[model samples]
Target: MTESYLLGIDVGGTSIKMAIFSNDGDLMEKWSIATNKEKDGEYILEDISVSVKEKWQEMDLQANQFIGAGVGVPGFVDIEHGTIDFAVNIGWRDYPISSILSQHLGLPVVVDNDANLAAAGEYWRGAGVDAEDLILLTLGTGVGGGIIVKGDILHGVAGMAGEIGHVTMIPEAGSPCNCGKSGCLETVASATGMVRMARETIEHNTNSRLYQIWQENGEITTKDIFACAENNDTEAVTIINNAMYYLGLATANIANVLNPEKIVIGGGVSGAGEDLLRPLRFYYDTYALPKVKEHSTFAVAELGNDAGVAGAAWAAKTKAK
Candidate 1:
């Protein structure tokens, strides 16, 4: 009667987060490893494999005690084949990550988009728990999202279902996005977007506190923007309100159609907490249909950084069953 364990791995640009979970969904241990991006990230998987093996041995665990490993990959991945189409940050292109990791660990592996895993994590153990339909928005350097319908992630046919950031928010006179598009949602609703907006504001309105802070610190951060807004700085408040307006409109549009039970907001910008959600909800309520608005709720994500690992574990466990 040996206990079984599930391994969850979240691969990021600079680091990899791994966690071991019990079959019943309890987290046993978690750790981080530096992602070796040398040689086009050729050694990233190898590093993960070696570290996992060492940790397993240190814990005196038998190989047979493990169920499988799940990975939250940071790019377009073909889940059925476990192939990564491209991950610009980590320099992976058309790499067969799933089979490679499976071979190295001698365990079955499941691979999915990192955002999808984040949503799954929230749905299983975080803010979206108990909801059959939900969406998780990660507002980091770039905005990423995941949509869950009926307790399952909605990975579209091209594995590009929940790319909320790339959705065109402004098609005319918008800033250029890294995705080679102009006026994408990522340009306005992400941490980077916040900073960019703040900078633009300071350039135009030299009297704003954000501009004063920028003059003192040489740069402004997302925190400064929210903090200034909290103090009722007109420009900061305007920037935040504008960003939330677009984000809310985008979310409400999705809710109008999908009518998810909940919309969970996560990532670095979400650290602003109520400051972000309050204004976001203001705009959401303005756009969402009356019926959908009443039924759908918005909340901050509770899982934080653990969402990816938790979701990866859920993927492994689900596939094992």
Candidate 2:
């Protein structure tokens, strides 16, 4: 009997990651290639096919050994029709991703939102492994979210279910978000938000250590802010706490609405470790309803970048069955 394999593809704005996994969820091989989304979508698909073929040949395996492929795209997808509705970050719109890839590679393919797949990855094998209901918040350059109920991904009408970042957290204050909304959660809780906060703090509090660091580096990023906070920079701590307040408020709203058993945080900003989680925990405790708060445990994501690939492979396997 031959073992079955699944190919998982995670498409980001700058890179395309591919991973091969055995049916039982063991990672067999993984690699990545540059993604020039400004080019045609078909070109990107062709590059992926070539990479997959190369990997198959290198491993001395035939295409028949693979069950299917799962792709997680950073965009809105019409899952039923397998079309990418739109992805502003990557400049894609209503692209026939599934049909194009399936025809090009001669294999069945499943397409879904990247954040949803990351949440599914966590639910299946990462932080949410113990919880049937889970919500995952990914805080990178932009914020993305995924919601799972009863071990299934929630693709609400238009397949835009887990877009928690765009949810209005503050209606009248703060910087405007790319979503055309003022004070959306992403405006306050994302890495971009953190940088904006740092800029404001530096202008007002020149005596702080963060100002000195910025004076030395000439520019302050979210990572630099986190480093300053670790060194007890008052301004850095203040900015992070401010960001956490919005994150907590957003998490509380999610809990009050979905009441999931677990909430998992991931992406670049989460690297702040205790600095971010401690304050977020405090805010969540202060804001969340008692019933839902008691049931949901907040934690950091364990899978890191591999979550999407692993989740995509798992999704492919599940769909194959």
Candidate 3:
């Protein structure tokens, strides 16, 4: 008998990652390619189809051995309709992803927002493996969130369940977000948000070391801010602390509503390790209800970039089951 496999695709603004997984949930092979978002959606699908077929051929595998394909797209998705409502970063709107891909590949396809899949990936095989309820926060260019309840991704009425980034943290501070809200959590707690805060600090506090680094680099970035923080620069640490305060506030709000077992943080900024987690934990514990805090713990994501792909595969397998 031949073993069945699942193909998982994680489509992002910059790159698309693909993975093959056994029915038992073990990854078999994985690869990635740059995503030309400027191109038409059909062009992107063509590229993916060719790449997936090439991968299958290289492995000397028959199409019948493959079970199904699952995709995690960076956009507002209607999972039931398999349509991408919008992807501002990629400039796609209302793309019928599932129908197009199924027509091209002759296999059933499942689609959902990438962050939700990342949450599912963590809940199934990563940090939240032992927990029944969890939430994942991806702190990248923007803060993205996913809420998992009872071992399932919670897709609210419109399938926009876990959009925690837009949660209001400040009523009248910071620049406006793409969502047209000022002082939204993502505007203050994300990598881009941190850079914005760091720039403001550099302008006001001339004595800070970050100003020197920014002067040398011609501009301040999240990396420079984190590096300065690592070197114990007061200004950088202060900026990070400010960001963490909002993050903690957001976590506390989520906890009060859902009371998850774990809150998993991921993305590039998470590389700061304790420097970020410690302050976040501090604020979370301070603001969260004592009972909610007692049940939930904060941790870094284990799967890193692979979380989306792994989650897509796991989702396909789960749907099949």
Candidate 4:
């Protein structure tokens, strides 16, 4: 009997990460291709198709050996319709990515939101493994969120349920957010938000290490903030504490309702490791109800860049069954 293979594709604004997995969830091969954005990304899926065919031929694998392909799309995914309602980065609007990829690759395709895929990946093989309920918070240039309830990704009616970044943290007199909101969690906790906080701190206290670095380099990064805080810089520590406070509040609120088994933190900021977790847990403990807090745990995502691709493979395997 021939072994079955699964194809996983994660489409980002800049590149497409692709991987082949075995039936039992072992990763076989992985690679990436530049995302062609010519004509408003019209050819992105076509490029993926060509690459997959080349890869399969290189490996001497027949198309019939594959179960199907799953794609983690970066935007509002309408799972039921197999379309991306809108993806500003990819320049797709209500585009039928699933059917189109299925036609191009001659295999059934499943498409889901990229953030949700990352969470699903963690749930299946990373930090949230063995947990029936969990939430993922990714802190990058911007923040992204995903929720898993009862071992399945939650896609609200509008496919916008787990937008934790856009959750209102400071509703009034708060900083502006890219989502056209005021004082969103993204504006307070994302890398960009950390920089924004640094700028604000420097303006008031130009004598601090954060201000000195900002003035010297004309910029400050989240790493700079963390470093300064490590040296006991009061302003830097305050900014980090404030950001984690909001995160904890939101986590507490979510836990109160969903009572997830774990809340997994991922992305670049998570590189702070102990520094981030310690403070975040401190705040979470301060806010979360005793009952829910006792049940919900915290973890850092084990999978790094592989989360999306892994989740895509899971989607394919799940749908194939």
Q: 1-321, model 1: which lDDT tens digit per residue? A: 464899999999989999998987889999999988999999999999999999999888755788888899899999889899999889999999988999898888999999999999999889999888999999989999999999988998999999999989998999999999989899999989989999988888898899899999998989999999899999899999989999999999989989999999999999999999999999999999999999999889998999999999989888743
Estimate, for each residue in 114-207, the C-alpha lDDT of model 3 and write its tens digit.
9999998888778889677999999998999998999889999998899999998888666899888888899999999999988888789877
TM-scores for the candidates: 0.97, 0.95, 0.95, 0.97
Q: Best to worst by lDDT, what's the order?
A: 1, 4, 3, 2
- CA RMSD per model (angstroms): 1.2, 1.6, 1.6, 1.2
**What TM value does model 2 have?**
0.95
Which clashing pairs does model 4 show? none
Clash count for each candidate, listed in order shown: 0, 0, 0, 0
Q: Which runs of model 4 end up more than 4 angstroms from their true locations?
A: 1-3
The reply for model 2, stretches above 4 Å from the true place, is 1-3
- Backbone clash total for model 4 is 0
Predictions in order: lDDT: 0.92, 0.87, 0.87, 0.89
* Model 1 TM-score, 2 decimals: 0.97
| Deviation from native of the Cα of residue 120 in model 2, angstroms | 0.9
Quick one: best lDDT, which candidate?
1
Model 3: per-residue Cα lDDT at residue 193:
92
Least lDDT summed over 10 consecutive residues: which range in candidate 3?
Answer: 37-46
